[model samples]
Target: MNNQHKPLQNGLHVVVVGAGIGGLACAIACRRANPPLPVTVVERAPEILTIGAGIHIPPNACRVVSSLGLLDKLKQAGGYQVKGFTLRRYQNGNVLVEKPMGMRMKTEYGAEWLAIHRGDYQGVLLEAAREAGADILTNAEVIGIAEGIGESFGKHMVVLKDGKSLVADVVVGADGLWSGVRELVLGRSFPPVETGDLAYRGTFTREHLKSFKNERIDQLMEAENVQVWLGPGRHAVFYPLRNKTEYNLVLLVGDDLPEGVRTSQGSLEEMAANFEGWDPILNTIISCLKSALKWKLLHFKELDQWTKGVIALLGDASHPTLPYQGQGAAMAVEDGAILALLLSRLQNQGISDVPDQRNQQLSDLLLLYQDLRKRRTEVNVAGAVDTRHYYHLSDGDEQICRDKELASLPDSAWQGPCSFNWGDAEYQKSLLGFDGLADAERTFDEWSRKKSRQANI
Candidate 1:
């Protein structure tokens, strides 16, 4: 694992579209995880703006970040480490479920759940990628993709808005929900389908919290913890951030696309309207909010194939999960890290020993990466969908059942395997070894070898 001396394809070039969280993380992970490879990131947007209100970085994702050597940088970026998650009744402040989060996760899983401003988090990854020898080009829209035209591997002729063309050995479509690269590969006009839920996301200052008299509300805004209020068909999370100076508010409501939510316009008035039935404290908090944006939560129906030829999708481009599980960005980060690892290894294996035979190795490696990703992301997607209904439990019996299930969990279950031991090198090794990928490839390889033997016979 001495990255500097590790062999890599001498001049392998990789072009990544979209410099969002996943793209940037992919670049950094590829550079730092394995041997260094030439990586270029093309972002269609001129400047990276903080569009997301807030995102939860679970312990597993945090482990990957720590493994990538981003803990200190994240801390410096004003990311808040969460202590625990408290589930409470929607109207009254009665604790329903309390799960230890930060230090507990670290002790059990060897990582902490970190919550950070999206902009700062993206900046941290982008800066790291740039410093790690990645050529980051902003305002470069990829309008066309030319696959395997001249080279055996393939070339992505990225036509920028300025009519400039760039080529690379591989093109990664981390472009996100409305990915142009996905369209080029999938061969369909697929769009992000709306989930009939609207998200009112905002960041509130301490001054704005004066209207909330609930002690639990005060605790949520001031303490280093995550609090979620669950109701019928709706839920809201209030958590402290920016060193407790500000509170991040996320109100998930089942409503049509409100006019105020779409353009990122409108005052706190529109935000309050969505919470009519919610507690007065919530309405008061929304009324005092200085800024807010409404996001139409769109969940993509699963695609049969995430890749074809040289172009492949990443993050939301591959699998878009609803926000219920709070693992959207986390899953994206994991995807980036694992893909980088596989490609880097393939690049190394090809350069020193098999230069002339590199294409097959690279192709096989990409397929392996896809195989490694598919089912795990599918599981998360299913869990996210399922949790949406679970959290928004409308039926009284259903809510009672869920409560019973939660309560029935033995204390030993809670204490069992809270987090992963990321410090162990063996644990890292396991992540690289796609369990199902290996099994499937093994089974297929055995069949192929058997068929060849029979032919010889």
Candidate 2:
């Protein structure tokens, strides 16, 4: 065994398992910190493969990635701007509402929403991590993790299936929803629980969509927008991708949820059948699919503790969000950015310290990450859940009521938060500040001192 932290070079030696978009992005983000850290990404699969379908990265996430200097690479790997999203009735394709993206979002939030293939995004992130000096190892499955002892003991030692072991100061579980590291940290198997909804996803070439270029489909294909077709117990979304060369389709069905489907894989046929009476374009998209992967929507209700000892969970491992708001991966990306930032701050405090001081620093850093993220993640998670309910509303009087509520906004109202009179610039600046770690430490110290003084009093 490499008994010393010598090769670790006085910097952090991190082991990030999974190598998915979240894992790879975390590695890349860590490398982008003010002072770069050495990172190792371990994946069970021999090699990464593109699977499933497209993913929508909202403005909030795009902004984080931009901060990491990956805009060019992101675009290169199938990143495309979405003009907006339109809500429609599947029967006659009547437009109920339209949400414009891109410039409108950029103007409002200082970033643009991007849509790209899941595999494509993962490829970009992995490549970026490699270029940034992150060591990525494939087919290195971590079967178990045990805590270490003493200062510079590197927190946890991961044992692989092949009997190989890796010790690291930080062991980040970016391994998605069914994370082994999470199971270890939580001391139990907290598998993902279904959210009573399943999704069908597929992608179509522009050529396949040529005949369907009416106003609704045209807006869907030409406009970088997400077009939703709502129906009874189901909803479908179509959006342009990769400069309009392809169109992404997703169908969310509420009833008849499959018993044993992981959120990652659901029956596309069931998803399609739920939308049987919907728009012809949707039906066409369904027919074009050789097979639709199943996606059982899952949410993280528990797993309150995101860290234990020196091991922590990032992205979906810590908090898995439903896909309703299309910000699942966006949230994960944000988690990566925030965690990397906090870890960087910790490393800045000098790695060569006493055991007690090191533990205190580590705890302070983690508490800060949780404090800054918990509320925001909870907000996004609630939004995702609410959005899912909104999309799956059964068509009828209730559906009409929901639609009216959404479209009730008057024309006088601004299209986005940007047009609102709120002080968005100042808000953005405040959010951009990187003082969470300091705040956490001060809060802890103040609380500790206060408790002591109160006892004396």
Candidate 3:
């Protein structure tokens, strides 16, 4: 326990477990609510480390970040406005798909697409959460949480590893893939299942590009556009970061990591071998790699419920998705944005309204949040799966047909099923043109009106 600080005991005290992007987003959003909800973010890490390589903030997530007031900060933190990306043939670097993003996307989706260093992004979010008056307790591991039980009933008891207890009106589990809160919610241990794929990800400084260059590399680096290579059994994505001073690369390939070993050091030799005979610029980028980490892609099956009493799952705790769509973090932040928005509406009512009224309202909102988000996230997850199929298609008739479809697909957003997974008009619109927060706001209002009519209160 951090005895240096005291917790606020009042209506709708939010306990956000984990201080990652989702947790911090939720903490800041709740703190900035109309009446301001008290939020305590409990992080098990002793300190916030400037970790991670790169992250994609699509227009949909950028809107949520704007709501959190960190968009400018992100821009100032060396955010790269991705002009768009080009999908290429792995062996010959043949252009397979090209579409405009960045400012053009702003015109289409109402927000700019950003590529940023994941560490810098997290740092900005953490700083914003702290400035918003969120109580952050680091090195505080949650061993157990009991909701709607004992005197803490309605309120929840969050037992820390250090034998301290936190009583909160609601517990938001923003914890990551291996979530302790999720296990408690399920009343059993449920770990994320591996997806038979591993990600080899790392970064490099532009100065290290001494070994490789070509027309393709020059054009891509000059335009500062995201570049993707789709090949047999794997795919790779590259984008500039930190004002193009650096580059981030992510390669997804079949998992060969020893069984039960989820993460380990990745050899540059293996990385090179994996994509041998591909684009020279990509291979050169790999040549400059200093170190890399291999991570197993994992996801959880849909749960029976994302909320139980005063406890609600957020981010990876509820729906862990594959990285196929680069929406893992995006989905987490979207979850935080909408969940906090709904929880924030329960403001002054918590103090004056009867306990029953407040609890029922909270319950309904959480369930509503689960109801709304589950469907959308599942779609996003399935989209990632669908993308993997197209991205890793082995060269043959199917691959040729996919490339053909990609070349023929319309550029503008359209209705109906997507034509090709890459730059598919409808899929891109669904992924980038969504405003989940706004949708939640409208739906929540309807819910409130419906409740009023039924109770006649």
Predicted structure with the largest TM-score when compared to the true one: 3
Angstrom error of the Cα, residue 158, model 2: value is 1.9
lDDT of 1 by residue, 219-252 (tens): 5566687777778888888786677777788888
60-174 per-residue lDDT for model 2 (tens digits):
7788788778888889887888776678887867877665556876776667778888877887887789999998888989898875655436355777887777767777888
Clashing pairs in 2: 82-224, 83-101, 83-224, 84-225, 265-294, 266-294, 266-295
**What is the Å distance of residue 422 in model 2 from its true position?**
18
Q: Pick the candidate with the highest lDDT.
A: 3
Ranking by TM-score: 3, 2, 1
lDDT of 3 by residue, 137-190 (tens): 989999987554444555667888888878777889999999988888889899
Alpha-carbon error at 195 in model 3, in Å?
Answer: 0.7
Ranking by lDDT: 3, 2, 1
Model 3 C-alpha lDDT versus the unseen true structure:
0.82
As a TM-score, model 2 comes out at: 0.86
**Whole-model Cα lDDT of every candidate shown, in order:** 0.70, 0.71, 0.82
- 1 versus 2: better TM-score goes to: 2
Instruction: List the lowest-lDDT window of 10 residues for candidate 1.
Output: 416-425
lDDT of 1: 0.70
